[model samples]
Target: MISPHKTLLSRFYLIGVVATIVGILVVAILNLATPLEFIIAQLQTLRQGGEFLWIHVVAYRFAILCLLATFACVPFLVILRRVLTPISQCLSLKNRQQSLPPPLELKAKQRLINLPFIMAPLNILFWIFIPLCIFGGTFAIDKIDLAAAITFFIRSTMVGFVSSAIIFFGVESHARKVLIPLFFPKGELSLVERTAKLSILKRLRAFYRIGSLIPLAIIVLTLFVLYLQVNAETVSGKTYGQGVLNFSIVVFILSFLGSGILNRQISRSIADPINGMLDTMEEIKRGNYQTRVNVVSNDEVGVLGDATNRMIQSLAEKELLRDAFGRYVTPEIRDEIISGRIPLDGEFKDVTVLFADLKDFTPMTEANDPKQMVQILNDYFKEMSAAIKSKSGLILQFLGDEIYAVFGAPVSCKDHPSNAFFAALDMEKRLKDLNKRFVQQGRLPLSHGIGIHTGQVLAANIGSPDRLSYLLLGDAVNLASRLQTLTREMDARIIVSAETKQYLPESQTRNVLVRHPQPVQIKGQQTKVNIYLIK
Candidate 1:
């Protein structure tokens, strides 16, 4: 990376060279293109000994004036360079140099903002001085009368305003584009109340008043001056008619060219940001939620960009959540939860809660390689989950070697109890297929027991405000888990509580039994539970 010192030095040279050339070109082109004897007329007014040798005299004086302007620049540049020195020296400090001290950065930013404001007034002073040296000097020498001197002075001041605007915007561009970024890097520089902010509103008004209005004004002033001096003549007795016409045309042409240049510059500043935001928005529409707008100013457009970035951040987080939950929850239920169609505060609805645990899986984990065990478990869950989802059940979680699922709350179905009973059967079938593959691969076979119960559950999104889950809560959920534990004692692959068995469609099994939930040895707390064992 280029150090800050070199960037600052380059910016100063660029602004100085460009602004000086444009200023000199506007003033000299208009002043020197007079048709005939205008230079001779000026020399006669100054009482110079240059009636026949006016061309040489004028060239010599103009060259001396250029030298004088250069001399004036030396001291002004020295002070400005001193202001830039501290930031450059600190940033260039080797190694440990990524950050700037806040105090130093703010001070450096203030100096940069002051550059265009400071340079512009001095530039306008020089333009004003040129007219004074010519017409005012003649008036002092009693060669030209006060009325003529005043007339030309007014015209020069208007042209000076236009020329100064060019210089002001030129330096301002360098300050905003390069120097401020090198020094400050962040924060709104336009809000640094030390100077007047050159905002878009001010820029439009400047171009309107100075670029367009002032040129038309200059043309009118030129015609009035010629009308007043219509019979005026030079040493060779040439009329002032063509001379004034030539000066007006030169001013108009320079003004038109300057307007076009400034217009294009300002338009780019606005259009580029707006275009970039449109492209970013298009990317977001196509699901690229991570894209953001680059903010470069504190103006209205910059505020819009900051707002867009904030909105994109929110959407990116939501997109991440949707992708993560999509694996566990069905799309229809997830959409209802996100869209606020399903109430978060609990609601009572009849649903079937199911829990399935892999039997003898703990000993299998100890015997198998850890990674191989995980692969077997993932395959088991994948197959079983496919069965549950096909019947419109939402798998709530896969807890180690177990699956916990629910049907008919967030999304209601008429046959949810039947769906849960059939899903349990499907899980058994898919698990057998998985066991066959596992045994073929020299992996241990797997088996699981399922318990399902149907009852009115207070089902809703439950958890803290920022995070929540659509869960069934009541005795039914505990009863279902208790029955899965009962599976080992009963030697059954699937068990159902009586409440759920009643809701099963086309129920045929006459396998109801009464059994205590606890061991018969633990006699005191035993309660008789009615259950059905599914084959």
Candidate 2:
């Protein structure tokens, strides 16, 4: 989208060029058709009783020179447009990227590039040559030919200098856009580098704009003083030069001052919101999600800030949701959902479910003090939970001293049976370690049996409205629990169902010395299921 500044500049350029052309054409037409006899006749009357006719002659010559100057300005303006259009395009692109440096830096850069060539020369022309020209012209009309001649020469020099400065400034300002890529060279800058560049650019722009006002103010003051000086002579009813001078001075001062004020205001309006946006962006870069910018003005910057704030808020909310969900699901599942890789709804997947139970828990509780049993069970559960988590398995639930864990539910793994088997092995190792501590403390040794089964199960959140438990419920879950009960009958520490034993890789399953593959009828099943005892 084209920016408002670019649009405004384009319109201004078009209007200025059109007006300049029309003015030049009108002046040229007048010069071509106007009778020199009539002008000479009028000038002769003004020159009556003067010491010389040199003033009238000089006035006619100045008029002809002005007519030629205006004509020449048209082509100069065309050449300026040719040089400036590409530069303007570059500036427009730079502005759109919003990579411009800060006001101070921009001012510095402008001083380095533009001041020496454009501003200083123009200032000299306005302050030295133009004033000398006007005063010299007046002296010439008063019959001091040598002084008038010098003044005219100074005035012409000032005009030439000023016009050249305008052309050079316009072209250079536009060309900066084209040459920026070559001098600055576009590459991916780190955040800090980009921000520093932006700061410099912004500062440079501010300084350039502020410095421009000084020359403009001087010009306005000069025009006003000149107007008053000429108007004072008119008050004595001598000539119309004073009225023309006064009107011209008023118009020039008003135009110059109004343009300067408007340009400054536009720049400030653009700069303020951009500054606010940069601050907010810096906050975000520092991981400050809580920072927000106010949309005070109904402008493009205001809208952008509002949008940025909204995006930050949205990201914060998502992070909160992800953290909360991590508590109920595995980090793997949470990440999958957050990354949009997995759907929320649970799917029927083949998973190995392991159930570990404290052997003869009721008798052990009766033998020990109730409080001591509770403490022992708490420590046992903590150890088992850690074991399961280490192998990337989720502890679905804990019922008293029994633990129900599942692998390949929320997130799947090709080696889920092996992972579940290792988890059970680790649990046994941890139990032995606990028993050693208990023995050292003169307590009873801990005994537990784990049963592993692999099958398709419906795994999801299940419970009443107030309470929810993410669980696996199917023949597979039942077979796993039943296998735990059969551990006592088989006189084994761990039992694996036929399905689990088959699914486990040969290398891992070879270590499991199966005592028997017994076909036993589960409580809810019509057919008997084969279960193996791991010796």
Candidate 3:
């Protein structure tokens, strides 16, 4: 099977070939329409000491030479292909990374784009001068009248200019749509320093505007030349009038063709960017924040691209902030806060609150080095926090060697009490593992007291206007802390309130072995709270 790249390359040349054929047909129709009598009269005038067929023979040869010269673009197309081949490889999905290295790609791209700018002027000059020299030289040798020679030169140059301009525009437009994308896939025309000043939009507009006017100008100039011919001492007015009519028809055809090409060029310049941005927006909507619009021009489209990039950047930063913020609070709470679902004014909810404190921590700190104490505390918090997070417990705050955790409030969890119970167990297991590591390092093992309670509490952002924190406000919070302090008197590691045990599911409460419930008055509570020691 033929490669897609080869097919595209072939199509590019095919477009040029079709354009060339159309150009030739246009010129041929215009030539046939010019008055035959006028041409015969010019030949008769040049019949001075020469065969009548000489001018006819010379005209036929000139047409053949023009055809051959136009076909010469085939070789030029080959050179263009060579220049763009490396860039094409870079754009190929299969060969993307293995294509020409960056430096080579840049050089190839520069050469490819610069090819048109460099060749257009030369092509135009070649078309204008070559025909002029051939016709003028032939007529001069035949002793043609100076007026007729000047007229022929002017007419031939105009035809050449119009034809060459069409080719120039066709080549430029083709490269822009095809080759340029391969070179700068993201439409990053800025990287090529030279063309950065000459924006693609500006170039396209200029080409369209100037190209549209050229055929009209050609029509006017052709009419004027016909008027001069008619008033000439040797020319017939009737014949010249017919010539003008035919030339006008040709000009109308050329103008129609030029208009079609210009409209397509203008549409591509505008539509391509709009379509690209739309696709990128769709990608972003699907949560792909990395997508960005390719800014190809310095116009309104470029402004839109800049705005899109900024929007995506802002979204990406916000996402990163949310992830970092989730570390301080739980993801559920963070999401609730962001979505405005959690009330800042506060609402009461039955939440499971748990507090854990290091036993004999003050004595340990007094005996150990400050840095070592800090390391141990950090290790303890890290392990304990991981356990709390695994059970969907939100860490409310850490006051020195104490940690406050809550289950259900900003976001509700039906098994909050059971989750809190499991989290306490996980913490005990983690503490044992931590103690083993400490003992292996020849350090004293650490212990902790944990108390859990389930009751109605106000969960909301609290504090001064400038600074606020999410806090659980109610007697349940104090009871939990007081029960943690009671761990020393009760000689238990974990204490669960009777209210919390009532919230636990039957499956969980069956496995949990608790000592006889004791009605104890908790500090800050008006009534006695019933609590149980967990085994």
RMSD of each: 6.4, 17.5, 8.3
Where's the lowest-lDDT run of ten residues in candidate 2?
186-195
Clashes of 1: 0
TM-score (C-alpha) between model 3 and the true structure: 0.63
Per-model clash counts, in order, read 0, 23, 0
Best by lDDT: 3
lDDT of 3 by residue, 1-535 (tens): 8766666656556654555455545554554455544565664566763775776767875798566556546665666577556646655643445546777666666765565555455555655665567557867787554555565556555555555555555665566666655655555454465542335567576665556666666566656555555655655666566667766777787678766666665567678878989999999889898888866554467557777877888999999998987886667778987898778788988899999999999998998899999999999999999898888888989999999999986788888999999899899999999999999999999989999998889988889999998899998898899989999878789998889888777785676647555688777888887887864
lDDT of candidates 1 onward, in order: 0.71, 0.60, 0.72
Residue-level error in angstroms, candidate 2, position 306: 8.0
lDDT of 1 by residue, 1-535 (tens): 8754676566765665455555555555654553324454664565665455666767886896577457545655665567566646555652356676767666666666676776667667766776777769878998766666765666666666765676677676655565555544433444665754556787788778877887787667656655655554332234454566667778768888878866766666567668878999999999999787765555666667778887898999998898777677777777877798777688898899999999999998998789988888888888988898888899987888888999886788879998898888889889888889988988778878998888888987778889987778887888888888778887888988778877765434444333335433212225655777754
Off by over 4 Å in 1: 1-9, 32-65, 68-76, 94-99, 112-122, 125-157, 172-196, 232-245, 346-352, 360-392, 397-402, 408-446, 453-457, 463-469, 473-486, 495-534
TM-score of each: 0.72, 0.47, 0.63
As a whole number from 0 to 100, the lDDT of residue 263 in candidate 2 is 53
Best by TM-score: 1
lDDT of 1 at 484: 84
